[model samples]
Structure formats: C-alpha cells, structure tokens
Target: MNTLSILPFFRRLAGTCRLASALLAGALTLPAAADALPLEKIALPPGFTIELLARVPNARQMALSPQGVLYVGSMRAGKVHALPLDRDYRPGKLRVVADDLKLPVGVAWRDGSLYVSAVDRILRLDGIDARLDDPPAPAVVRDDLPKETHHGWKFIAFGPDGWLYVPVGAPCNICEPDPERYATILRMRPDGSQLQTFARGVRNTVGFDWHPASGALWFTDNGRDWLGDDRPPDELNHAPKPGLHFGYPYCHGDAIADPEFGRKRACDEFTPPAQNLGPHVAALGMRFYTGSQFPAQYRNQVFIAEHGSWNRGRKIGYRVSVVTLAGDRAVSYAPFASGWLQDESAWGRPADVLVLPDGSLLVSDDQAGAIYRIRYAGERKASGIPQ
Candidate 1:
C-alpha cells in the first residue's frame, strides 16, 4: 500500500485508542454518582416520592428559613449556599451566600438573622432575609472556640428557652479532654452570655430538635469507629431536662460498655439512648415530622440522616431512618427513603434532612453533592386533576 494509505490507517487507530481511554475514565467516575452511601440513600414508605432537588458540594448541615429558603453549609468548600425552592420543593436557583470561611459546617436562621458555625467562631448576619440576593458582612457573635479542627464544626440552634445550643465534639476518636473541650453540649444566650453546659459525655451530636409537645431536646450521637462492625452502635438520645448525660467514652449505644472509657462505672450511671441506631452510622441532621401533609402516623416521628461508614469492611447506614416515638421512647424504626447507594462497591454520603413549610422533606447528600425532596401526593393530587 502507498504511504498515504498507511497514514490514514494509523490516524484511525490513534483516534480509536483515545475514544477507548475516555470511555474508561467515564466508567470509573459513574459509580460515585450512581451508588448511594449511607446518608444519601433514603428509603421512604410507599406513596411518597423522592426526587433530587439540588446538587451541593460537601454539604454538611442545612437550615430552612420561614420564607421557605433552604440554606446549606459545606465543610470542604468552606461556604454556605442558599437554595430557593419552588412550590413543588424543587430547587429553582442556587446561590453562594457566603464563602472562604473556616470550614463552615452548620447554619441556622432566627428572627431574620442567619447564624453560621465556623471552626473557631460563630458568625451571624443581621437582616438576612432582606439581603437574600446580597449577603451583608458577617459579624462575629462568639469567638475563641477551641481550634481543634476535628469535630470542631458545630450545629447551632436557638432552643425554645431562647438559648443557643452548641455541641463541642471530642477532637480525637476517644480521649479524655480538657473541661472546655468536647464530649459536651453547651447553651448560651444569643449574645454569647451565660454559657452553661447543658449535657455532657456526648462524643459528637450533629443533629438535634426540640420536642413539639414537651419542649425537650433530642439529638443523635455517632459511636467511635474501629471497634468492630457491630459493637458500640450509634445513639438517639433525649434530654428531658438540662444537665443530662448521654454516656460517651464511658459507655456507648444503649448499655454497651466502651472498651476505652469504661472502668469502675456502670453504664446505668449515665442516661441511655432513647434507641440505638447502628454502629458507625455517622448520623447527622434530624427533624420531627409535625406537618399535616403526611398521614397521621408520621406525626412526631423522628427522621435521621445516617452518613454511612468509611472504616468498616462492609458498607452500612447510607439511608434515612424513622423512629416512632411512643411517649418518651422509640417504639420501632424503619427506612423512609433509599436508593442513593446503588451497590456495595459504590458510595453516596447523605448529611442532613430538613422539613419545609409545605410539609415536604429535603435531604442533603454531600458525597454526590445533591439534595433530594420527598413529598406525599394526597388522593386528590394522586388522581388526575378534577374534570
């Protein structure tokens, strides 16, 4: 064959090789998007539909405003995003509200002010509702928080008592810390006055909600990792009153004695969890369903986002679970929404769950950088529009 003919054949072979390489790269990237990690896969009951609402990178915790705006905080990005929702709970526009902070992981809105938790500071923006399109300068409400990066980011909320509750997590996986450091929950005035320890011996609790009927506090605690796959399950605790202790370091999930912190004390000395969630589940945001859109059974049920596990050999806890509260204790548990983690080899980590004013559920997935909306279609809506 002539030289020109050979040149064309070689060119075709090179193009074919490039195409094959591109396909391989895409194949490797697809699983991370397709498979659900513990927090990303939520299993809802029948008749409820869950759809991806927004995709946010490294979302850690979320807060919803009274006007129905969804604000999300990110750990890796060190930023907060405001996601606007339409009538159907679908995200309409996503805007970066603030950025370049020190690992902002939590966000809250109260009285038109926005409060955000950075690693070593609690910052707030006044008249946040008026500046939704243009975030004003943030003022430091409280500083001098411990500089330890691990578990330093916080979930901040203004409880019914008008006190701001902040959780300081243990810096290390397991260690006795200075009195000012982790394993405790603290409450203070909105102006950072009258700081008091509300609860102690709590390793790390990222999500909490006040009881609708009783005004008590409830939170989720993550168990220590590398303690086998089944021992020391995570916890869902209730603080009927302040100064309560949910055993950490000394005890774990229900009555399981910690191998590291247990010595001469009995697990009964500390208040046990309302229920044991699971081992290494990394439970994050939680909310109580008090809306009327769902059936009567869903009222007062607790919904939690399990962020899943990384240290375990086999994956677990990539979905949201509901805890049925019977008076003071959890009677039973079941999955609410799932399908985020597509397979055992893949992962999509969910971080937070928020309920909107319209009685819809919004779930934030950090790994996949997406938020999902779950809503119940009533009989009238389920059927075609009335003729």
Candidate 2:
C-alpha cells in the first residue's frame, strides 16, 4: 500500500470512531421516554402505591383479556396496542394490533374478540387473544353512525345484559340535533344488530359500568362547555332501565337551565343527575372497583378517570377520583390519586381505569402517555411509598 492510501484510510477510521462516540454519548444523555416520566410527585392514599407500569403513547381506553393480555386504544395515534403481562402482571413487549384507524379510543374484549370504536364505526378483530403478534384485519361491526367529529370519540363496553353499549356524542356543544340520533347511548348485539337507543340526552359519556350488586348502568357524562366555571356540572348518572333522558341543552347538573334552550322544556321534565361532579372536570372513563386488594370500604365503589378540564379558568381533575356508593346512590366523591397538576401545569392526565384480577387497579394516562398500576400494600407502607 502507498503512504498516501494509508494516511487516507487512517483519517476515515478516525472519523468513524468519532461518529460512534458522539452517538453513544447522545444515547446515554437522552433517556427513553418512559424513564423521563416522573412518578415520585404523584400522590395517592394510604397503603396504596402507584407504579409506572408501561409506556403507551396516547393511551386512552384499556381492556384486559381473560388470558392476561392488555389491549389499549388511542385517540390520535391511530392504532391499538397489545401488551402481554408476565406472571407477576408486568407488561411485556408492546405490539401494535391495529393501525390507521380514526380516533379509536375505546376497546372491549368479549368472547375472545377485541371490539374497538372509531368515530363513526365499530370494528372487531376475531381471535385477537391468540394473534396479538400477527393481528387479523378488522371486520366492520357498525358504520352508519353520525360522522361529526366534535365530541365524537366513544367509550364502549359489553353490559351485563350481554349487549354492546356505544355512545354517540352531540355534534355541537349544545345543539338540539335529531333526538333519535345524537346525544344518546345505543346498545346492540355483538355483531351490531338490533341497535337501539338505550339512553338519551347524554351530551357525552366517555365511560360507564354496571353495578356489581344491582347491575344498574351508571355513566359519567361530560357537561356542555361555556357554562361558566362553576355553574353547570358534570354528572354521574344511573339508568337501570332504558328510554331515560338525563337532560341536555335544556337542563344541566341538577337544574341549571341552559340559556338558549331552557325555555323550550321545563327542568322538571327530565331526570336529574345521580351525582353532580366537579364543574368542567372532564371526567372520562369509570369502572366499578370489583377488586379485593384495596380496603373493605373500596369494594364495589366507582373509580373515575378525570382527563382534566381544558377551557376552565383554573385546571381541575388531572387525577383518579373515587365515588362511594350505598346501594345505588353515590354518597361521597373524593380524590383517590392526584398531583398530576402542580398548580397550572399538568404532567399527566388520567384517561381510563381497569381493575386487575388480583384486585389492583390500572389507570391509563394519555397526557403522559403511560399506564400506572395502583396496588395496596397494607398500612405499614401506606405513606405513598412504592410497594
């Protein structure tokens, strides 16, 4: 080899080594997205600890299969994710089960199939439990829904009656759209047949669950916006039977009449809310605490994921809340987990909640793009310490 060729070769080798060193330094300095999410500042109740379980981008609603796979849906990611849990229920590698869907924020698992709700349609993936790695193409369950995107995202679940329940939000904030179509909760067979409106006047309900004792349907309905910061309130409603209207555009909260539509109908004409939640809290997903891990008082209660208020003068509800129930009535409402909002800035927002088989609870946060596991570790370790 000539001297000139050897000198050029050495120069090239030095350049390659420098590039490798810079890349390694960058990799070490910039941590994974999940590792950057701070969890120590979060506050929970005594004997309960919260852990960052998995990092799922735009994580919204969640469904757990009987075989321990956690299927997650997203709002803007346009994909559904599956995370297989290990023996200790730790999430394994993440997999994209479906992609290129529009605002598919709801997921429900039934009979080995995964049901997902996009804005104007519902799709089902058959044998999803067995094919998380190579998911099958989805079959359209229903597509005739209204196409409006305003408040259009839905939260779906199969009821105790063995029917799939879906919500269609009102197109506008406070419009009197077609009574038969908008602002209603509709139920149908798993194949999307026999579809009928189960409840009406629901402005937007992103979450609901049946009572463990009575099997009554209860849901969290987000009240209309621009109702001032404290006038109208979000609702936790109960509908044991069908054909009930909880008052929309006409009446809000218990009896706060709407300015434009109040004169059209009397407030007494419609059923009031079962519980008036915080005004403009943006409560989304809720579930009955069917777990035995928490204290005795926590059994069969309701856990609500308040996604946090957007337009209010002050921020509210970037945390998980608890609603205590006596029989069918909500007796008390309190914060179960909080501290996501430090003053005006929010680091995380709770989206959906699911109860585990071992009685722990899983809360999904779309703001921080993570899922958190809340477990009870007895009173000795109750001081917000990780158990």
Q: Lowest summed-lDDT stretch of 10 residues in model 1?
A: 378-387
- Candidates in order, TM-scores: namely 0.85, 0.92
**Which stretches of model 2 miss by more than 4 angstroms?**
1-34, 379-387
lDDT of 2 by residue, 8-72 (tens): 88999999998789878854333454255567677778778778788888999999999999999
lDDT (Cα, tens digit) per residue for candidate 1, span 1-387: 688879988999999998789878754334434434243244557667666566677887888887767889988898898877666565666788888998898898888888899977888878876677899988898897888888887888889898888999999898777645678888888877788899998989999999889889999998888779887788899999987778778888778787876884689999999988878878888989888888889898899998888788777788888999998889987777655567775456778888777888878888877777678973221211111
User: How high is the CA lDDT of each candidate model?
Assistant: 0.80, 0.90
Per TM-score, the best of the predicted structures is: 2
Best by lDDT: 2
Scored by Cα lDDT, where does model 1 land?
0.80
Candidate 1: count of backbone clashes, pairs at least 3 residues apart or interchain: 20
